[model samples]
Target: MIRILFTMIAIGALTSAQAQTIESGSHSTTGYIKSDGTIENSSHSTVGYIKNDGTIENRSHSTIGYIKSNGTIENSSHSTVGYVKSDGTVENSSHSTIGYIKNDGTVENSSHSTIGYARGVKKEWAAVVYFFFKF
Candidate 1:
């Protein structure tokens, strides 16, 4: 009986640990960019933000990178990661295109795959943007 109880406790501890790890993973935010360059989530939460100088911040308000006026996006370490074009198409640092956000609010990939959409508007337009990850 003691052995069975110990096993159960071990299982419970493992399950709890796994849950914590999953909860700490990257979180998705559905938000709009304010005219002042702040990113707010649907719940009105400030998931991230943009600065006048084009610096971007994460939910924790940590400086993640910058977005230049020319639409070039760079990381905090100053590495080119992607670009946001005038036509609404987003491209990687290598200039390889991934998707575009249409005027009607549709986000489509190179293959024309609809990934997501944006709604509403502000003095500064908001877009359904994606971040490029480098392995």
Candidate 2:
């Protein structure tokens, strides 16, 4: 009986480990995953969506949002789109020049905005929003 019990325990552990290995490769989650592979916060204050390779795609909050990548954004909260930078900055139509910082550490809002950073009269570096796609 003792041997049978040990076997069962070992089998359970092995199964769980095997499951984790499957997750380590190309993991994708529509919900949330704890550091221990346990699901948490299905839907609530922290309602978020993450992808495999530990990248967050879409995140929602009562007051703020955090997109952790420097890519094409089809839309934004204020009816705009943006991109990201390595310095966690976001460039959007709203902010125009000084793009905001994304939740992740990447520069953003460089897609449909200006491509210049200039100094203001106050001796502060400011973003100059101006760019023409030339149709």
Candidate 3:
């Protein structure tokens, strides 16, 4: 079951930029993931960024973490923090399932409860920003 779940995450290279809305489970607008990788609050204030190279940065441009090409997530110190698997299974450093990013962009907790949504956004980005709160 774990293997099957891990296989479901859609890992891939960063594609062309397209702005996407981020919403809470209740469907309230939370923020926006912009074409240029800027993360903004509903008020349109810059909050963070997700670079094309998978580098996560704060509003101040400090390195926060990384979502690697092969689905490995690393902290600024370059330590393995967690992973957003190819199948959308989000696991901690210990490799235990914590959440999931569904194909339709629905974010779910380990119990499979809907926690948020990131429609039209890349699963890895959605997982990091919405699920992991990396930025």
Candidate 4:
């Protein structure tokens, strides 16, 4: 009975996960960022995932990258790829300012041109999905 209860709790947790909509700058639905770490397209196809320990996995579950607790981004080989600053500034490995994820969910390029939005999504996750990878 204890085991069954635990299983039910786990299932409940997974089922309770929420998904935040991702949108283009024009506000058209583009994709989603699920609370359980699933990244899905607007059509509801799984595109990628962000694991609890910051490991990023493709749809096939292959390790692709990571987002460290300190906001450091890394590639599959564990090489530093970029960073997401607390203020929403995004920088490349060379520390060049590459983009920004605003508090309002607006995503902007180095030139400050609006590219997209991921409202209600974590900034680090938004940076990885929007700037580091195409998914």
- What's the count of clashing pairs in each model shown? 0, 13, 5, 0
Cα lDDT tens digits for candidate 4, 45-99 = 9999999999999999999999999999999999999999999999999999999
Q: For candidate 1, write residues 93-122 as lDDT tens digits.
A: 788887776776566677777665553331
- Write one digit per residue (lDDT tens) for candidate 3, span 60-104: 999988889988888888898888888889998899998999899
Local distance difference test, candidate 1? 0.59
- Judged by TM-score, which candidate is best? 4
The segments of candidate 1 whose C-alpha lies over 4 angstroms from its true place after superposition are: 1-29, 120-128, 132-135
Alpha-carbon deviation at 126 in model 1, angstroms: 5.2
TM-score head-to-head 2 vs 3, winner: 3
lDDT per residue for candidate 2 within 1-135, as digits (tens), equals 999999999998876543111011123222233332222232422333323322233333132222333343332242334443344354554544445332321212345332222211000001111111000
What is candidate 4's local distance difference test score? 0.94
CA lDDT, every prediction? 0.59, 0.30, 0.84, 0.94
Off by over 4 Å in 4: 1-15
Clashing pairs in 3: 8-87, 9-86, 9-87, 9-88, 10-86
